[model samples]
Target: MYDALVVGAGPAGLMYSRVLAAKGFKVAVVEKNEQLAVKPCGEGISARVLKTAEIEKSDYNRFISHVIKGAVIVAPNGKEVIVKEEGEMGYVIDKKNFLRVMGEYSASTGAEIYMKEPVKELTFQKDHWLVKTRTMELEAKLLVGADGYLSFVSRTLGLEKPGERKVIPAIQYVMPNVDVHDPDMTYFFLGNDVAPKGYVWIFPKDGRLANVGIGVQGAAPKAYLDKFIKMHPEIFKKVDILEFRGAAVTIGGMLSEIVTDHAILIGEAAGQVIPLTGGGIHTSIAGGKIAAEVTAKALEEGNLSKQRLSEYKDKYNEYWGKRIKDSLKGLHAIEKLSDDELNQLAEILSPEDVVNLANGENVASVAVKLLKHPLFSIKLARALLS
Candidate 1:
């Protein structure tokens, strides 16, 4: 029996395995897909993710696709607000290679990674878990479900899943040779006419290549993306679509309870994603590190009870709970706004306010800003309070 068995080879599982193995734990990771990063994603992460993943600066070029400095927010009326920071803001990565690098690094640290081995069943004995994959039966002292939104292990363990309303459909295309206005900055287009309850994003890589994507609620995501592309001829007229990808994203905040008697949930499986932006890379990396460390401590102490694993939940919440809750509130309020209201909000919000609100910071300042707006003083106040 292994010390820990992680389901899924995504960022969380790989990171968890890497950290645990580095601590001298016997860890194994099982993935359903033959490859990694097959899901559609915006592929953006803040520079802080490097520290959280414990990646070396000398090895960044192995997976870094583009170094981004900031973002451009375009209002419904096409008015633009540019957001920039003092140093490097984020990175657009070659996601497949990034996961592979992390997985290989984990393997080098003594974690066994099994790809294309979809978990078939999970049976709980008194003190350990019997995991059945297609070809073999494995046992583990601790089971971690990082299996993602449709996590089989979570369902089998009777963990609470994110509600359907909290899940959104997203689609993206990898287009090269497009007329990119600024390859250094990612662009966000916001308007109901464009994406209804969601937004359109253009994350550019080197050489004018970009991943243009859309996430929408209560509408066909591909249809909306195509319509947006067709409407923005200035950007898409001559661009060739190199790839099309789609996936379901969880926009819900973190779940209330992620630890069971002898199991733990992390990553998308635990709804640890930013609600308004549907971003999870940074959060997942941080969550994986915390979970692994907590599991390691619990193992060393010879206690695998839920109370022991709850430290992971406590630490993760201490770091991200408020931000996620605020972001979820922000999402609920913004999604209820009409295009006209969004445009008005664009007029009232500054670049700093946008950045702060997006990160679930300075929310009171945002409310104060909205209260100063003659039209939004009461209407949005009620929305925010609700």
Candidate 2:
């Protein structure tokens, strides 16, 4: 039996597998797809993710498509607020190559990765799990579910599938040879008409290439994205669609229970995503590292009980749990505002305030700023402060 069986060979599974193997544990990662990063994504990530994943500068540059300075937040009425960071803020990565390198690192540490092998069934027998794939069956002492939003492993764990109320549907087109206003800066468009309850984003990739996408809560995302492209002829005129795909992102906060006896859930399966921006790349990478550390301790002690495994949740919470909760609060507060209110909010919010609020760092500063506006009363400000 293997020390751990990791489902889904995405960044999370591969990362933890690498860590476990490095710690002298036998780990196996099984993936459904033939290749990695086939899922639709904006592929944007902060520099912190690279540090957390322990990738060297040369390897990181291999998969980095663009260096991002910051973003331009546009209001409904066409007003724009430029949020610029002092240095390299983030990167739009070539995710396929990134994941491949991660897998290579994991494999080098003696972790077995099985691709194109979807998990057919999971059976818990005694203290081990019998995982049946399309071609073979394997048994392991622990099961790690790093599978995504529609994770089969999550269902087996008796967790509720992310419902429409908990997820936002997003669609993106890889537009090559497109004329973007600024290739180094990302763009965020905010308006109910533009994306209903969600927002639209234009993240530039390499030269003349961008990922243009729209995420909406209650309507068709592709239709909205297409309409936005048509209306913004200055940006999307003469653009060629190289690829397009749709995906659902879970924004309902992390699940209360992510660990059970001999099993753990990480990545989007457990809602390890930023609720406000639907960003999971960083959080998931961090979570994978934490899960590996916790699981390794449990193995050394010969204890795989739910209580022992629960330490993984505690460590993850200590790291990013509060930030995620705060982001959910920020999302809730902004979702209640009308387009006019958002426009007013944009005018009053400085770039630093936007950064702080999005990161769930300085709520008091933003609350104070909002209180000056008559639209946000003492009650709303208090709500934000709380």
Candidate 3:
């Protein structure tokens, strides 16, 4: 029997496994994919949360495709705002390399990674979790679910979805030879016409290659992407389409419950995704490390009760619960804002304000900042109320 069994070999699971192995606990990680991180993602990771993950800079530097210095945000009415700071602000990483490093690190710490092994069902008996995979059954003192939004373990456990659960269908085109305005900057387009209840992004991986994508609350993502390209002929025209890929993203904020007596959920399974930006890399790293610590303590004490595991929830709430809640409120506010109202709000908000909001800062604090610009307060009020 292993000390811990982790489902899904994504960033979340790998991080948890790595921590457990470092603590001298036997860890097993199961992943369905033959290769790691082949899925569609924005591939953007912020520097703020990297400190928490404790990934050495020299190790991940090879994976950074581009250093994003700032963001160029275009409002619904085509009004533009630039939010950035001195030096590098974030990274457009080669996610495959990032996952490779994480996997290597986990293995180096004595974790047994089972690739292409999909978990079938979970059975808890005799103070151990019976994890039934495609080929065999293994027992573990603790179970951690990191499978993602459509998690089988979470469903099997009968944990209800959080109220903030709103899925966005997103599509992306890997276009090479594309003429971009700035490779150092990430671009965002906001409006119902471009992306209904969502947004469009252009993150450059190189001088001539960019990830052009759109996330929409509505179903027709392709139609909106077509419209977006037509509107920006100067940049997208004559570009060679490398490939197209997409997946559904759960920007539903956090889940209601992420822990049980003997089972714990992390990453998307726990709904740790940020609502406003649909970014989960930072949150995943933080959650994975936190859960690993709680699990290690639980193992040391030999107490695997849900009541003890609930400490995971308590720690997460103390750390990230309020930030996620504030970001969810900001998401609701954006959903309520009109095209004109959004433009007005964007114009008045400083880059610092945008940064704070994007980083999951309090919306009420943002409202207080808007007091300097009186017109924004009314629009912000309307957005909040709506």
Candidate 4:
């Protein structure tokens, strides 16, 4: 029997397998896809997460945009506010190469990797898990489900639905040859006209290449993406379409029961994506590390029971609970702001506020800064109080 079986070879699964392998655990990673690459993503990760994951800067293809000096916010009325950040700005990654390097690195660490093997069913029998694929059955002492939003392991484990608020739909595209300057500065557009209940982004990868996307809360995403593209003819006119992709982003947060009886859920399957930004790369990586550590300890103690797996929950809560809660609260604050109010708020805050906002700071802090601007304060106060 394998020590650990990770269902999904995405970043989260790979990270877990790599960590466990390093600890001398027999780890196996099963991926449904035939290969590793940018399957579907926004293709951006903050410098913070990169550093935290210990991913080398040289491992990725670099396309410096604006040094991410800060984020620029465009209100529905075309007003703008630029917020300067406190530290090294984040990088827009070449996601395809990033994934390839991650896979290679994990394999080099001695993790048994399998592709094109979709897990069909999971059965818990006599203190172990029997995982059934189309061609074979494997037994493992522990199981981790990192298989994106529609996680089969989660379903098989009988975990509660991630809830409506947790699931978000996103549509994204890579546009080549766009006439955008300061590629390091990420841009966000707020207003129902642009992205109802969600937001639109322009993340530059390099000189003229950008990842443009839109997300909507509890709404069909294709229609909104088409609308966003149609409404921005000026930007679209100068850009060439490179690729298009869409997927669900878990934003609300994970359910209460993330681990039970020899099974654990990580990544999007556990609703670890940032609520406002829909960024999951960092969370997934961190979650994988935490899960692996917990799994390793449980295996060493020869107890893979629910009580032992509870360490994963405790560790995650200690690490990311506050951040996730704060993000959800901030999303509520943003949701309440009217289009004009949001535009005005964006225009009033400095680049620091923008960075803090994107980095998942407290909404009250952002509110206080906006209150300093008379017009924005009035608009925001009315929106919040009403």
What range of 10 consecutive residues in model 3 has the weakest lDDT sum? 377-386
lDDT against true structure, model 2: 0.88
Candidate 3 lDDT over residue span 205-276, tens digit each: 956788889888855999999888988888888987787998878787777877887889998888888888
The segments of candidate 2 whose C-alpha lies over 4 angstroms from its true place after superposition are 161-165, 377-380
lDDT preference between candidates 1 and 3, better one: 1
Instruction: List candidate 4 stretches off by more than 4 Å.
Output: 37-39, 62-69, 85-88, 162-165, 218-220, 367-386
lDDT values of the candidates? 0.88, 0.88, 0.83, 0.76
Which tens-of-lDDT digit does each residue in 49-89 have in candidate 4? Answer: 76656677676444324345556777889877775556856
TM per prediction: 0.96, 0.96, 0.95, 0.89
Question: Distance from true position, residue 49, model 3, in Å?
Answer: 3.7
User: For model 2, how does the per-residue alpha-carbon lDDT over 7-34 read when each residue is reduced to its tens digit?
Assistant: 9988889899999999999999999999
